[model samples]
Target: MKDIQTHDRQRLAEKLRFLEPDVIEVITTNFCQQHPETKEPGEVDTTHCITDARYHLTFLRTAIEFGTEETFRQYLRWTTKVLQTRNIPHHVLQRFLEEIFHALEPHLTDSEKLVVRTHFLDVPESGLTERQTPARSESPLALHQEVFLQALLAGDRHAARTIALEALSSTHSLSDVYVEVFQESLYKIGSLWESNRISVAQEHVATAITQYVMANLYTCVTPSQPSKGKGIITGVEGELHQIGSHMVADMLEMQGWDIRFLGVNIPHQAILQLIKEFQPTLVGISATMVLKVPIVRDLIKDIRNHFPSAATPRILVGGSAFRALPDVYRDIGADAFAYDLRTLTTLLS
Candidate 1:
């Protein structure tokens, strides 16, 4: 691969930030085909597509297991469309299916690459099965998000997601739920996934279901409330995680700050450009994988260099990677380590 240009790298990182597996493959195939080397189903392009496909696929698998079907189906259509048109490689497709639906692989019972192989035959048959009866599980919600989520978890994701939508709509602000209600629920779900009580797919399902409900609520948000200070949060060039930043954006928004969410896998230059353009009060960086830690440190250093003329926005760092080495925050020259959303209350204060 060529030395990726700074802006284009960020664009690629952001382009398919949260795409499902099938969609990522579709995108990779299209992207590879657009380039000279990747046009054919060669081994090199196949490898690249496979790697990228897993990122999208794993997330979707998690979502399907935990989130509402409404959320799963919403993106399912988009993914299916991409699969239908994009010329993805065979083995790569199989690998993606294997990762997401691991348990089902054994059930293939001697069939030759049965799992993803069949799904690969046609894009439309990507198994976005809405008609399958969800087992009745949760109590119907007259009000409360608890009831909604309980219902959602119980197999009536359609109803759960719908109620969540109503709850989000009733909120005076799009960001209102994040501080306590949403954050707490997210943490609980994470715990469930971590404890092995729920699978990664289930966690993903919950996030997808919640995100869809939130997206609808966000659209209705309309920024009716007046703004305060502005901020931007992004993952460094090589990093792909965006969950922590989502929390920051919501917290800042709830606190009346105008936040610009540049999103996952953003490059140093793009962030710098936004900083220069928006003149935000703080710049937040999130890194989920430890291997990407240097990217975060370097990005902060670069941002510091670019804003020499005035008060550089405070740099904030957070994510799983930082959990082990909280001291790294100081070494990296970040002004704040937003270890939690509440940390911002003090920093922004």
Candidate 2:
């Protein structure tokens, strides 16, 4: 898997994304035609097939680009549970995956074909049946997280803000509020959506509420000490998840690092220009989706190319993208990878 060339992975990912709509149409249409019973009244809706196909293709693209076949397999296992929750037959999923492989087989190189076959196509149905449940933490802030999550789920931004502020006023520090309450609650909301227990709208609302609360809490954040150095943090291009980066920015600001957060989907040239203008001591990049890992690599490469080796800022990376593959930062030429604020502080020290 590591032997797969970078350009080949990038090319395959781009090709898969480009052919997404056509491939989905071919697979879904053929499945409906061959399994007409799926479209019968009260049976599996064709819309579900289209939705699943889109997610399937996306997972495939990310897995290919990141050279993490386990990512795709994990997605399959999770989707199996989600489909079961929705009353969709397991065989329908199996058949759809087969059709997808056949649809793309003609376009793949012999080695790529073998990869798809060996990693994706050969998984036993029995192996995919394992169900996973979200774990409960018995930490001091778990109760606060539960209440905060409920408030967000109810779209009560005001209540959520109160909860967060109250937690901050207690024994919890600012970092505790951010990590234990805000971050943990958001993680639960995401898991609920993934397990098909919550609608997309609900997830969005919960996220928006959390963002609102975070902003409200920011007013209370004061630097514990004088400024140490300047830092610029941003989510990589095409990475829409910004809250993690936002949290990093705030935490660093509170720790007395002068921070300029550029938000999400920032272009590489724009980032390079900013680095030149700001001349920060640290450049922090966040990528949430595995699909954006290649973009992060390319961005880091471009940064290295644009600046002289001695003049380059220490580039640090974090976010959920690297959670399953922590050493990916080393592979991508990053100076360091920090999993959270604690590790970030250690790295800077």
TM-score of 2: 0.87
Q: TM per model?
A: 0.51, 0.87
Q: What residue pairs clash in candidate 2, if any at all?
A: none
| Model 1 ranges off by over 4 Å | 1-158, 162-176, 219-227, 309-311
Score candidate 2 by lDDT.
0.84
Compose the digit string of candidate 1's lDDT tens values, residues 200-220. 777777777666655655555
lDDT (10s digit) by residue, model 2, range 268-311: 99999999998888999998877678789999999999999887
Top of the candidates by lDDT: 2
Candidate 1 lDDT score at position 70: 35
